[model samples]
Target: MALMRMAVAAVVLLDLGIRSTDLEAHYTNLGVLPLHVLFERAWNPYEFSIHNMSGLWQVQALLFLAAAGFAVGLLLGWRTRLMTVLSWVMLVSLQNRNPMIAQGGDDLLRMLLFWGIFLPWGRVWSKDAEGQPAPASYTHFSAATVAYVVQIALVYVCTAFLKNAPEWTTEGTAIYYALSLDQVLMPGGRLLYPHFELMRWLTHLTYYTELLLPVLLFIPVGTAFFRTVFVVVLFSFHIGISLTLFVGLFFVINFASLMGLLPAPVLNWLERKLGPATQRCAGYLGGLRQRLPAWQLPLQVQATWRPRARKPGYALLPMLRETVLYVLVGYTIWWNLDGIIAPKYTMSEPLRWFGYQFRTDQHWGMFAPAVFKDDGWYIIEGNAANGRLYDLYRNGRPVSYEKPYSVMALHKNDRWRKYSENYLFVDNSWMRPYYCNYMLRLWHLNPRNPPLKRLDVVYMKEVSLPNYQVSEPKREVLCSCEY
Candidate 1:
């Protein structure tokens, strides 16, 4: 649990740092969704966000910095419970503020933080460890234990079940299609794309692994072995995915979640192997804990740090805790199941109400059943006041190539790439206006550029795949907007 906490917190910090570069563009009112409109349309009374309190970009930057602090506090186990809550709030708020960029990784990170709040993640390798009683040899059975295991398993199982598309199961071309797409593909994808047959076989292996491996989590016998195997296999899977896709933090977050599933025996063996070094590290951390200011010291101190023995808590404490745990566990199960059998097994209104209130509602059908077939690039044409046409994106360059050189680095993050995907279809007319205006705004903001009177959204589609042959670009005007 401690290792999991540290890993998750580390990922949180890394994610925040990456996002900090585009804090204003991604998290402020000036981004995709303005704060006032979002508050009106999607705000829940139960949810609170500091990110929404101001429209100033500086405020968002401050909030981002504060979130980074909370993540560090979580990693160090300083005021751990409070830090966990704060970290979860900031994560949810930032993601909700501009949901356009959020992906499966963000969802997984949020859920892990939610569940981490209920576990004793600060029990070891933390500054709080200096003033505490020792724990039992094995982790005891509790609602939290069950919930954590079940939640992880549910994500894998739900995804496996939702992959009913023939591309994944029958044709075994899911990975081929995934890699061939220009948007999410990394340079590694270009190198690997030619091996279509290997990708097909790997696709089948991925499906079965996702489907069957989760079952091993529930087996009581050889729990350590099963969990160890699960962690290694899933970690490797995520690493491979990371190598080929520009999926922002998704792979990292999933790798962190695997740390939580590692059994106690494995941790114990690790501790034994690292014995003297572990003690030295703990002592170093203890010394640092002592140097903390008076105000901060209390946060790192254990709940029972006094010299005198304290009376046990009232009988109702355990009962109350158990009640809350069971309630949350039941809701977690229903929430995941509903997502798996969506449209067929919808959650009851009350369940949904609670889910929205907690911001815990989730779906796990990642790249399920079918991968997108349409591969295209956006061509933004600007008609300047000087009666000259310009490619607003590439500084007046013509859109001749099937793939943009910038596609390799065009998207700020995966969310941008995913958002671009929505504009590919003719039915997604909603994107045209926003995209057109966005292009116009960019052109107008550039002092060196000529003023544009109008902008047009054009798409050039790639009709051939599985073979790298280029077809004549099928160009179509998606929409045009006056600047």
Candidate 2:
């Protein structure tokens, strides 16, 4: 639990820091959607957000900074419950502020944090734990624990089932297409793209692993061995992906979730290694306890003196807790089932109403059924006050100068990279506003430097396997902004 909390806190901090760089553009009233409409149209009724209270960029920035501080508090296990709740609220708020930039990884992180709010993850290896008695090593179980394991398993199992395409099964070309795509690929992909046979074998292995690994997790025999293998293989796979693709926090978030499943034996080994350090830390806290007023210390420190005595009321409390867990479990199960089951079981309106309320509404499709074949990049054009046509993208050059694999370099970060990919799809209506936003951004950057005119969505279609031949670039005017 401690490891999971630390990993989650780290990822949240990184995500917030990344978004902080573009606060005005991504998080405030000045942003493309603005804060007011985002609250009414994008935010779920159940979500708690300071962003909804104000549209001012400064207010958003302050909230972002506060969220970052909360993440740090979560990492250190200080005021764990409060920190967890604040982190979840900020995550949901920030994502809703700019839904266009969110991807599957963001959804997964949000759900994990929501579940985390109900878990005793900060009981050990945290500042909260530090102030406890002589030793902090402890263990307990809750319904939330069971739900967490199931949630991670469901992610992999559903993804495996959804990958029922010829590209993944017969041809083993999914990885080939994935690595070849200019949008997400890193330099490592360029080096890996030439090895067709190797990539094909890897594709098959990837599918089989995702399909079978979750099953092994449930096997009672040699549970330790199974978890060790799962942790090793999945961590390696995510690391390889990170090296080959700019997937934002996807790998880190998923990898951190796996820490929750680390076998007790492994955790025991870790505990043994850190035992001495913990003892010294605990002793220091013990000394502090001697000097300070008992009430002045944090609650965790105070708890040692007045540990709750078991009472008859505890029996009723457990029943109440389990009842709430049952409701959450049912909702979560139905949530996943509706997305994948045939004929699609629809939850009642009252239940479906909770979709955004808890921010657990999810779609688990991750490169499923089929890998994309048509991969490309965008080329924005501008007509300057000098009456010259500039690429707007390629340092004021003609569109021909646009590099084939420049998408990785062009985007500010992984969020924009995924946004670009989504913008190219025919179904994404948000592209118009995004394009308009881009023109406005350009105007702000320089009032007359190649004054903005129009933007184009040009796709430099990539070559697929067996044929491995590039096609001519295709261009379409997606949106235009005057003045």
Candidate 3:
């Protein structure tokens, strides 16, 4: 089973290599604009800014080479650990350099690489282990397996549970907006927009599948069936997003996750096909040991003769405990669904006062203009009547201030303005109005913002307000500027 999986992984790697040139072209082009921005900010570094790359293009090129090398190593199963590590590093660096360009697959790929590292992925099918005795059993349940399964489940569970929001369920319109969004991002977006109905159905299916996936995990027969279904659904999902959003990274990640669903027989077959060279390598190592000096020979023998620990019995008690724990954890996750799906919209009154709008405004002209300033430190000032300033920091250290302006005026800020000038400001007012309305129309979505209760306002005025009045102020005094 392990060998078959390795073979499958190799095949997948080959496919990726074949597509590398085209993918690299897209990656390189997407990164160029950010690289230029980073170069411009060569003096000061910002957390999502590219200010630190001394030789930005060179770094990107090196990363591409590293990714290619890792892929080759993966295919050959040579230095599998090192290769997996390098691949992860390359992919993560690329992602961190410009997260905006990354899609869902990029996130999944990075995680899957970590999972691959945890498994003895190279034990049976690797060139490095050629001719070594293959393990008697291949289906040992390790922490890596548990972690990988848990992580994958989390993605689906969270995504599904989160869709409980009015936007996803009520109108079922999330699909329409998502599909329509491509028209503005891609060159020929208009052509894709007409397929709104298809996109809508896709969206519905996605939400439904994600929501029910956790149940499928526990079902005996359903596990394999659901895994297959998920792969197909995710692949189609990635294809849709790629075509519409022009994001290919998500597609790769979804493809990689398919490894989890592979059968044991397939992996074993691969090992048999590739085990010869591995055996030869082991023989060579044995020969080298024989050539070792007398002084070191005893130590080597001692190292090889270390007593193996007895394996623990898989008793019913532990199984029951694990089952109970899994159920409890699942329930906990289900309870926290709101936080995962609509983090911005689901806050308490006090938190909402902090200008944490759950759903970010998508339309133009919703923002106010403001001049942001720092005195060897940071403070943001907003231009609109309801605007408020902010102090930004990370890890208790001050970084930069974030001045909240209407989405329309976000570009007016010198720092952000440049990003909008070249790249389409998909979040700006120009795009938001159509998207929000279109989504609302299709989904029959209701705003998540809670209505201001009369009693709640009275309490707020006394506790949180600057002054109180009988008739509540028509214009809201936006949140405070304190951290």
- Write the residue-wise lDDT of candidate 1 on 120-151 in tens digits: 88866677765454443336577777788888
lDDT of 3 by residue, 1-483 (tens): 233235434544543453344332223423333345433432123222221243344555555566667767775678888877766555555445443333344445656665576566776545665645445444556556665666667667666654554536655555545433211234333455556566557667767776676565556674556665665666676666555543333445555566665555444454566555655665778764332222110111222222365556746655775575455334333433435546664545443321112111011110001101100111222222223211111111222233222222222222122222323333332322222222222222234322111110000111112111123313222122211
Better of 1 and 2 by TM-score: 2
Query: What lDDT is obtained when candidate 2 is compared to the true structure?
Result: 0.75
RMSD of each: 4.6, 4.6, 18.2
TM-score of each: 0.86, 0.87, 0.49
The lDDT values for all models are 0.76, 0.75, 0.42
How do the residues 1-483 of candidate 2 rate in per-residue lDDT, one tens digit apiece?
778999999999999888888777666666656766565545566656667677788888889888999999999889999999989988887787677788888888998898899888876667776645522323446788867877887788778888889988889989888886777888888889899899999999989988888877878799778878888889998998898888888999999888887876787677678656755766788765443321121222223334568898778987888788868877887887774676647676677767767688877778888877667666666665666666655665766735564577878888877767766667665556655665557555874465555444445554444446666655566667665
Task: Point out the higher-scoring one by TM-score: 2 or 3.
Answer: 2
Displacement of the residue 191 alpha carbon in candidate 1, Å: 3.3
Q: Which has the higher lDDT value, candidate number 1 or candidate number 2?
A: 1
- In Å, residue 194's CA in model 1 sits off its true spot by 2.1
* Candidate ranking (TM-score, best to worst): 2, 1, 3
Native-referenced Cα lDDT, model 3? 0.42
